[model samples]
Target: MIRIEPRQSSSALMTYGIPVLSAIISLLLASIPLTFSGAPIGASYFEMFKGVFGSKFAFSEMLTRATPLIFTGLAVALAFRARLWNIGAEGQLYLGAMAAVAVGTGVFDVPGVILIPMIMVMGCVAGATGMAVPTLLKTKFGADEVVTTLLLNFIILIFLQYMLEGPFKDPMGLGWPQSSPILDQGMLPPLMDRMRIHSGLIIALICAITAQFMLARSVWGLKLRAIGENPSAARHAGIRVNRTLMSAAIISGALAGMAGVSEVAGLKGYLTSDLSPGFGYTGIVVAMLAGLSPLGVVAAAIFIASVFVGADSMSRAMGVSSYLADLVVSTSLLCVLVGGFVARFKFVRLIQKKEVTQ
Candidate 1:
């Protein structure tokens, strides 16, 4: 009989080497699709590399793409740490974008300093409320959070569509299904005048650093990790499980909502259904790649963003399908998951021996 057994300790190799190894594998896997598309594998990869790091503009685009990813990644990491399955971050992101538009689209007459804060606050609240509904269902009615949260994404998307198409649509948009542009004063300033990179990148980094610090040094962090590792033990030790979970969920949702704020105020300066490009769902991948570490999420987000940006560049240059990006990302995620599983468990073959004395 073969049996799988849990590992008693974390593997340093798995922790340190897997990401590097997974990255290499992800790059190598691109060759398969390149061959299928009749593209020169070597030149395709070169273009990808160039797109990500060869030019200043390419690098800036990668960072720009990473901004919202960092926020959503942190959200997933924090929630997963507390065993909260918050699959509705996509919806929360839309809610946040919607809220920002409501406030930043001439709804407030205040200065950017005040108007910006209001926009961010409303976004955070909207995101928190999005997660709160599912959390409440899980806690109060024993409903499955995975189901509720996943379903809520559709509800929120439809609501956003209605708002944009009917109530919030820009009259001057020429029939486009998008909201009015956010006021100029409400926009986040650029990091550099000639680049698309904005102050939002700084905000994302600060949030990542702050989250890491909290997870490392704070009491709530201790409770969160403890509950994540073993909720029964945490409860026996007098920790309030439900309360901690609720707080974590709120923080997670708030972080995700902030992604919406970043996109609207910093990048697009407007709200639309296409604002996210699935950043919320991709954040789950980033969190998993980072092993649920807040700081690691930064690196993971950048890496994923690079892959996407590079893939787009490569696709355009090589005349191949853009879906190659998804293929590579999915492959990378699978490798990491398989590596993690190997790190956490081992299989043993049991040999039965018969007594000769019989």
Candidate 2:
């Protein structure tokens, strides 16, 4: 007989080491696809590395790609910590983007100093509202947030399409389905003159640091954490479970909304359906890979971003399909899950006597 048993005292080293070990294992696994593609695994991998880190331009692009991920990852991590299961960050991101375009365009006529902050605040509000509806449904009507939030993503996408093609459509786009351009004052300035890396990177880093600190140190965080572990016990201990969950959901939605603002105001200078190439969904992967740790989310997001960016370059140079990058990333998640299992549990083979009657 064999049994799997969890280790009562898993070491800190094993906790951190699993992600690193799994990452290496995942890379090794990626070579299989390269072989099937008839590409030289070593050369392809080398090209990928160069694409990710060889030049300043490559590094900047990787960070830029990671910017939205950081926000959405933090959002997911925070919501999961509260057991809210806020799965609508993608929809919330679109809400934020739409709000940004609505406010940042010439409608406000405010100075850059004021317009920028206003746009950000409105974006956060829009995101919060997006999440709040589903949360409210869950709390008041016994609706499952997972279903409501998941469905909301589609609804928000349809709504966004209508806004872009109808009210907010730019006349100068020449029939393109894109929102009006954001004013110059509302644009997020790039860190360097020629690089696309913008202040949104700084904003993302700040949010991650703040989330980590609060999750570790704050009283509200403690309550949310407690609720995540056991809602009934937490309630018996005098924690207002519903209120805590609501607040956490709002915060999560706000963080996700910031991701939208980063893309539209910081990178694209306008809202569009493609503002997020599933960044919201990808954020879930980032949060899971980070083990729901806010600080860990930053590293995970950057790593995932580097993979995609490098994969693009690799695909172009190696004549391989870009879909391989998705395979590699999804494989990384699976490896991490297996590594986590290994870190926490061990299999034991037990001696058994044969049945004498048989």
In order, the Cα lDDT scores of the candidates are 0.91, 0.91
Per-model TM-score, in order, reads 0.95, 0.95
In model 2, state the lDDT of residue 294: 93
* Candidate 1 backbone collisions, by pair: none
- Candidate 1 per-residue lDDT, tens place, 274-337, comes to 8988899999988888888899899999999999999999999999998898888888888888
CA-RMSD of model 1: 2.0
Alpha-carbon runs more than 4 Å astray in model 1: 1-5, 346-358
The stretch of ten residues in a row with the least summed lDDT in candidate 1 is 15-24
